[model samples]
Target: MFAVTFFDGEGWREGVVEADDDGQMLLREVALPADLPRLDGVIVGGFTDHHVHLELVDVDLLADSVLGRVVDLGGNVTVLGDLSARFVSLRSLNDRSLSEERSDETKRPRVARTSTVIEFAGAFLTPPGGYPSDRDWAPSGSFREIASTDDAAAAVAEMADAGATRIKVASNSDAGPVFDDDLLRTIIELAAARDLPVVVHAQGPGEAQRAARLGAAALAHAPFSERLSDEEIAVQAASVRWISTLAIHDDPERATAIDNVRRFHAAGGTVLYGTDMGNGPTPVDLHPGEVAALREAGIDGLALVRALAPADPRDPASVLLFLRGDADPLRARRLTPADLKV
Candidate 1:
């Protein structure tokens, strides 16, 4: 049996425990195998970067890190599809006799590593000439500029065909034109009909409130461009999940976002640890700065670990993270995926 000190959520320290791969939590007290990996650190379940863009990052490079999955929020459909299809056969990215699996988990887990998988949202559905529409970095088929309600439905259907587990809506009014209420509703309704949760990149004055009020499943980023009103914050916390991509921004914006998310977290909103990996310069693995930002937002201990984890029951994997330092993951120095000891 393999050995590790595991944190089964909450607060428990199972020292040097051994367990076999029987899909059950054995936690044997007996001596571990001599050739087995000695993971004496804090072992949490596999991590998932909720918001990423695989088109910009080196997907193959993620193998060595501890991250077990990544959710590609927006990217070129063909590219994303090709990538997923290529990795589809691997039970684990490492391919150690692991096999693809099916379960009751919502989006359907697809392991690409020892237990890693990449769930992708086909493209960013936005208004014509929207934020990413004109951006040089966003390639063709990466951002679909929907014209009408029916058009939006068609685009979402196309994404569904492309194997997007959820829908990503670009409601960034600050960057350029975005979806109006009617179009937004069309997209949301269509996505919901397909059982896809809509994640919005809500920015600027009323965009956050609009997305929240319209029942967005999650906000791609913490509402940052403007400070949300108490009512808006309440609505968002009550309805939307927030993907924490806090470390990429600097003062004022970063500070404002942290404050808003802190309130949301306190109000019981779900917060997933995400780095927006390719938006700027960030490591290919778990980000310590992002982890630190989450701590500063008042999410510590088990909550922090949960945020860093795949958090979604639908995307569970068999891998584990063995952090090398402090048992309290919040104070842990070895937080990056590269620093993962086993």
Candidate 2:
């Protein structure tokens, strides 16, 4: 038996649940308030990782990390499917086609037990020559370039048919045309028609602004490529949710990342905690730098927890989070991953 503070969709309360020999427990509303003994340890809901690439990071090693529920922002869905089978508690997938490909059929990518309950964003939609096409590390078959509004709508339908739960689009461009407003709007509308949310890769000047104006559900990274004005910040706060992938900015542009986060938080924008794991030589799991950077940007305690909580686009009411040891409720607002016990 273990004592834990359970967080249902509504609120938190003390409860006891039995764990198996593997320290695993399944929670459902039906088994609540039963007679149970005090627990040796409490597993607050599992850590919800907003961004990660489980395939790139060692699956076994990441399974031991603090994060319990992870969302893979981008990667090879087939690889993610294979990893999902091994790690039943790990929840993530990259696209619908990969999900369909893995369904009780071929088994090139064996599933891991911990890889159950994954949600995929499908292929990334970008201009013909956008940010990912040039990247040597971009996984093949992951980029879907849309040339027009009709193409955008068709792509959304195709991904939906492939069983995509969400749509991913890229607005940033390093060498070619960025998605025009018409195409962006079309993608969002089509995704909305399918009841899927859109996640956009927003960077470069005006990218974040455009995403906000176009009602993008979330931005893949903090707007670090450019400094947003107060008006722009307000616009973003009113709309798009920004995922804080601050650790990726440790390059010479660290200052930009910090500043972007500071202004975004100050403006009351939603910040989802994320580390672009596998994008470079980032830490394999709950990155202390990313947590520290969020603290530096003025998010603390409940705010930080909310940002780190795993998000389900379909079920906005469902959220989960965890903290090791007796984390000070007040100190949680200021804590870095270094301060956590596990």
Candidate 3:
């Protein structure tokens, strides 16, 4: 008999379940009510970090940490795909400047790296000279500047043909011009036709509103430019799922993050846990700072756990994550790298 904790959609129940020859027990048996409520350890499904930059952190170290599933929001897909054991989802950015004069390289979106399976976002379609184009850390083939509906549709096709599972667009204009309403709507409609979700990196005043108005499937980062009004929050609540990268905001901009998250949470927006790990000096695992900050923003033990844990959108019965020993949710919230023995 193997000690296992079970997770059904609600919470974890403890029990002992028989293991197979390979030491793996059927997830369904473990989650059964009769099998639960008697186990010595806690078994939960693996945590899924919806947004992370694997290029910035040590993959080995991250595997040992809390994250079990990681989605690379941006970076070289080949590098992220090579890591062992951990499940990885990659999205390649399309910002390479192919010479129009050079026929061979012109139409082909640069496939700088290759991966086993990548949910590639071919390019970040932004207005001319947008957000990431000028950033020092921005990778070479990461930002696509689109000027019209035709350009937008063609860019989407290029990424799809390049094997992109999804599309990424920059609706943010803090650095420069943003995608106008017409172009934004057209991109959303075209992507929908292909059954692909458009991930938008939206920031500041009009960006979040525009993204929501255009029906973006997800927002790459929590809107930090301003506090979203009830009307704006309602719009987002209708569709968008905010990927929380609160730790990316610096000391000066932390207030903006807190305020925005508060409003989003108040309006019942679905918040998915993410860390822009590669953006700066963040820990390899679930950093205590992120947890503390989230708690301050009104997310506590249960809700926090749900956000961090991998969620199966379709099936309720799936692999569960287990945290062994007597770990209080509040104490877990306060855990630092030193406290994690595993």
Candidate 4:
């Protein structure tokens, strides 16, 4: 596209950004290039679905969605690794093999080395019988049962060896047994040693607070089971990012999460736009409910837009969603990957 429009945290403006056919971005103040034939439609930056489950959802549907990037939070590490292998084109195959051989300690995002980058947490690390372990959706062998701290290092290593860039810890106390503080600390320390971030599925009372104080990179979902206290909210704001899966909730819990996010954002915590896509009725990409839910949690306009584009601003703009009119994320309905111009 010759011209691009983006949100400036105040309002939408034209010509604030430009992109080339190679999908790289240029954030220049100059007007749209008059040389190239003007392409119609308003262009925004690339989109990311901060949380999804490819094992449960359709991968082809995701490829056809608005996500320029995706983060698969929990699954079988080998399964995700096999999925990543499918992304290598003939041109990048040699480079991919070379990088894999060279970077054992380096945990690059797993899904795409070339286009539509996908970062993954590999598998679920939960205490024996915790939350998803009993759920039918969590396939057998995908979750590591941390019965003791003795198994922590090995479990973390298994995921790391399977090409996990980040680790997912399940702290769902409401469902079943959970790792004690010591075990939690052990997992966190091991992940830190590997230079991988830890993403926590913090649920139940005080669980989110614990994950926050312990230095997890982000919570897989905004805590919904209970309202967070001022101290809990502050610690989370100070140390963790909350991926906004607010649309995937029912009342009392949904309201609870919204208030927590509102306070957390007020306390300077970062919120990312994500939908637990496979958990229920969430759309493949840019789910209107997710955008609307984020807006309800007080992340309106530019702040809202920023949540959608969570990656580094200087990152190449390979894929982008084109708006037909005013840069209203909520108003843009039926937007699929087909609507994205790369």
Candidate 5:
């Protein structure tokens, strides 16, 4: 049996779980059995890192981590697609093995493991001669440059066909030319037609506000280039969900980014935990630095957990996170890959 703590979308609750008939684990709203030894940790819902570049990391290492799901914000479509298929195959094999083990009257669930789910955004959709196009880190086929408004529909269609659940638009005016208002709107409109949310890498002055004003579902990062006015912050808080990649910048900019996120979060803006992992020497699992940065932004306790967890913690299909050391909900931090059980 395992002792656990979970946020039920409203408040944190304590629970106990044990392997049931057929070798599946079940959560119970009761005390731990006195005779049974408890696992040394508290269980929460599986985590999802909303922004990652899988092509730049050793994705296979994620199999043992608590990140049950990862959203590939930008990557080579073909490579990401192949990687996604590989995880699916592994999941099937694991499930079949578990079923076979149950038939043999196994007493314990095998090692408590699950494959990391991949939700890729295919590639970065940018304008002709745009950011990342000239960068060596972005491999071939990782970015599709839309030269005109006529190209928006086709570009979005191509990504949708490649199993993209979302579209990533690159509006990094700091590097080079970015998508103008009309072209960006066209892409957003086309993406909407396919029921895909447009998440933009909004950089440079006023870029974040532009993405928000034009109905972007999310910002790939909190606006870090410049300090947003109070009106801009309110607008973003109301409509845009900011993925907290707060630990990826250097000081002055990093401090500015934190302030932006702090105000945005204070105004009731939704913040999702994300580490632009491939961009730097970031860890593959739960990042302690990112967690601490979020704390500095005033998102602590249950609010912090909500940002780190999946949208629905109650989903039985979602992976359970066994946090090892500090189990106190209010003081949860220092989460590393070793802390995770599944």
Candidate 6:
């Protein structure tokens, strides 16, 4: 058994773990034996950056970074589909290594790292001439415009067909036209039918509240344009998850975004770590700036670690362990991709 320290959603605990043949840990609640060989570091499951754009970043770099998985909130379906396929193929190829390749029995296997898992929301489902449609940064086939109820249904259907793990909708009123209440409702319902959660990029006044009222599963960015009322924040905290893209904004908006996330988290809301990478200039790997912003927003230590864990973090054994030698595991900034094995 190897000595380890892991985050159990609420806090970190010292424990002993056993690694399977594939170098994955079998975490359990057991007493640590002093005589057993112990590794000199903390161990954490795989980390995921909840929001990203594959089109803008060199995705290959993420495989070696601290992030084991990334979710592309909006991108060209065809491009993202092909990219996801490529990662799957890489994992398949890597899994075929000979068992005898491990020359040392005492030391744990140093398994070859596989490509980062890419979970994408096929395209930005938006109204005609919506936010990203007018942005030059958005690639072709990245945003699908929905003009009617029929359009919303078809757009959701197309995304589902493309193997989108989630449906991304945009309501950037500052950029251009946004979906009306009826149309937005239609899209949410359609996504629910396909068992896909809907994440919204809600910009402009009241857009964030509208998304929560209409049952969006998450907000791509913390509400930056407006300050939500206590009542509004409370209601949203009960049902919606907010992705922290706080560091991406400039002053004033940056302060407002951090305040919103602070309150939301205080109200028992689920917060996911996301940088909105590729929106402008951001790191392709684990972002220290984003981590700083989250720390300022009252999410730090084990709470911050929980945000970076896999989306479905129920099974601890399924994720990779991050080993940080002689560093404060609570300080996420000190942890990097080099600390991860396999």
Give each model's whole-structure lDDT.
Answer: 0.75, 0.63, 0.61, 0.73, 0.80, 0.79
The model with the greater lDDT, 2 or 5, is 5
Q: How accurate is candidate 1 locally (lDDT)?
A: 0.75
In order of listing, the candidates' clash counts read 6, 22, 15, 1, 0, 0
Q: List residue ranges in candidate 5 displaced over 4 A.
A: 1-4, 13-16, 21-23, 28-41, 102-109, 311-316, 324-342
Please give, for residues 1-342, the per-residue lDDT of candidate 2 as tens digits. 444555442345565444222222333333445555433332344356676765566656654455556777666555555555544433433222333443333443321123324456656788888867777777776677888877888888877776566788877765566888887888899999999889888877788788878878999888888777888888888788888888788654567777877887888888888887787777755678888888888887667766766332113112223344554222222112122222
Say which prediction, candidate 1 or candidate 5, comes out ahead on TM-score. 5
Worst window of 10 by summed lDDT in candidate 1: 332-341
Candidate 4 Cα RMSD (Å): 8.0
Write down the lDDT that model 2 would get.
0.63
Please give, for residues 1-342, the per-residue lDDT of candidate 4 as tens digits: 344554443355665344333223444435666664433455554577889888887776655455667889988888888777664342166345434543233543222223456678887999877878899898656788888767889989988888888999999988888888888988999999999999999988889988977878999999999888888788888889999899999898899989999999889999998998799866777789888788888998678877887333233324445556556765443223223345
lDDT, candidate 1, at 216:
86
Clashing pairs in 4: 65-337
Please write out the lDDT profile of model 1 over residues 103-149, one tens digit for every residue: 33453223334535778888899888887888887867888889898
Worst 10 residues of 2 by lDDT: 330-339
Off by over 4 Å in 3: 2-4, 9-19, 30-37, 76-122, 311-320, 324-342
Angstrom error of the Cα, residue 152, model 4: value is 1.1
With candidate 2 superimposed using the best TM-score fit, by how many Å does residue 189's alpha carbon deviate from the native?
Answer: 1.2
Q: Please, what are the lDDT tens digits per residue for candidate 5 over residues 1-342?
A: 556665555566777666543454556667656665455666665678999998888888897677878999988888888899999888777767765664443353343355788998988999889988999999789999998877888889988998999999999999999988998998999999999999999999899999998989999998889999888899999999999999998898888889999999989999999999898898888788888889998988778877876433344444665555665332332222233244
**Candidate 5 local lDDT, residue 73:** 91
Candidate 3 at 263: error in angstroms? 3.0
User: In angstroms, how far off is 38's CA in candidate 2?
Assistant: 6.0
Candidate of highest lDDT: 5
Q: Which sequence of candidate numbers ranks them by lDDT, best first?
A: 5, 6, 1, 4, 2, 3
The runs of at least 3 residues in candidate 1 whose Cα sits more than 4 Å from the true structure, single-residue gaps closed, are 1-40, 92-115, 311-317, 328-342
